[model samples]
Target: MAKKCLGVREDTGDPCKRPAGSRSDFCFAHRPQEGNEKILNLQHDPYHCPDDGQKLWYVPRLKLHRCGMCDGVLLNEKEIDPLVLESVLGLSKVAEEGLAVECPTCSTDSDLSDGKFALSNFAMEWGFAVQKSKYHSVYYCGVSNVGHCKVCGSTWFAGPGERDALGKNVGKERGFWRVQPGGSKIWGPLDMQQRLREERLRLVARKTEKRERMREKLCQHVDSNGERCNRRKTQKEGSEYCFKHRPK
Candidate 1:
């Protein structure tokens, strides 16, 4: 007699009723994919992925829990370095101000606005020229793509592609320096861009206000022939007449 499949249904958490495949404990429908057999025999309770609501599979080889559907990775602070090289991007500090996702391990909500965490894109660059080498690091202020949980130090990368995307350099040209009366400061590209945009709008508002004042001060002098003098007032002393219509 064929042995019963030793697989549990994800939705019902019940053993699979199908017969086991040849030389395998699971049937074709319950067969583990390549490199993911360990997930079938979970020693502990599985955690649900916060991003896709899928079952989080624990991979013993990598010592991390990963979502098979969305390909999102979840790991504690200690397990981060060995598996993810991008831990140097400062996941703890770069999570932007907002609630990203809940922690799969502890179910704690990861909110960056609680004043303990900061947000932005953590970037790095390195190159080699013959026998010489150079490395640089910078931060992009408005990019808050990665989700981080401060409670358990679990960082969530939406997918493997997002992890690779964080490795690229956000060029320095996009940043700008701001000089103030007290001192000077360097601002990230996105932050500086927003500031410059607001300044331009302020200048435009001032010009518009001046034009409206001039329009209101248009000379009200009427000639004896019944034609109104519509010339603009240029006097700073509050004279209501233009040079051409001023009283002699």
Candidate 2:
């Protein structure tokens, strides 16, 4: 009997029924290319990072695609719960309104146009035991933004350290806070709502700051007629012109 392929299908989350290739656990179509052990050959086309044009590598073990350049992570809807559980033990959290971005999967599909990834704020609670008293600490997972594709149910973590920040308080006690006997009070639903509101305001402020910075970096190149291009710069560093107007 021929050995079965070890590769998993991304679409249906089922094992590939194809026969394994000689000297490999996966079939030829599912075999990971040489020099890229972490990248898998999934059923769907490869995804690219929206923040950076870098190709997203499919990590079979993790069931997600990660951007090598930006450290961003993309996950399917089914994978979200498992990740949350692994990172923060699925603790009660809050999410704010979504921020829109171009969807990686839908962008490549010819049938889809203007598909968007709506990023949202995911705040998880971390409980700390200090002097035998429990205190709650809220951690936001969207320091850099966690986007979700409304069209495909995919989640994107635009990362330099977003994923790490999500799991920062996992599995460990960090600091101690002195609390009076009656000072340890449990937060009610209203308190959580207040915290969420505050977080939304902070996020809005941060977004505004980012927009201002980007506006400052707008292309400074003038055309032959001396009209300013007024477009965003291609690179964050170096040239001041957009890709089309940049000098060779």
Report the lDDT tens digits of candidate 1 across residue range 1-248.
99887665543234468998998877897776323444553423566776678876655545666666655566567866532334324333433436455566665233343434321323221111121235644322222234555556665554423311224333322211101100113222334435643554555566678877867889868899998788877665878788887777
What TM-score should be assigned to candidate 2?
0.37
Q: Give the alpha-carbon lDDT of every model.
A: 0.49, 0.52
The estimated TM-scores of all candidates read 0.35, 0.37
Q: Write the per-residue lDDT of candidate 2 for residues 185-238, one digit (tens) a residue.
A: 311133443454466466557767887897779997888998878888887578
Name the weakest run of 10 consecutive residues (lDDT summed) in model 2: 175-184
In model 2, the runs with Cα more than 4 Å from the true position are 1-44, 82-99, 115-142, 161-248
Model 1 spans > 4 angstroms off: 1-44, 82-96, 108-144, 160-248
Task: Highest TM-score: give the candidate number.
Answer: 2
Clashing pairs in 1: none
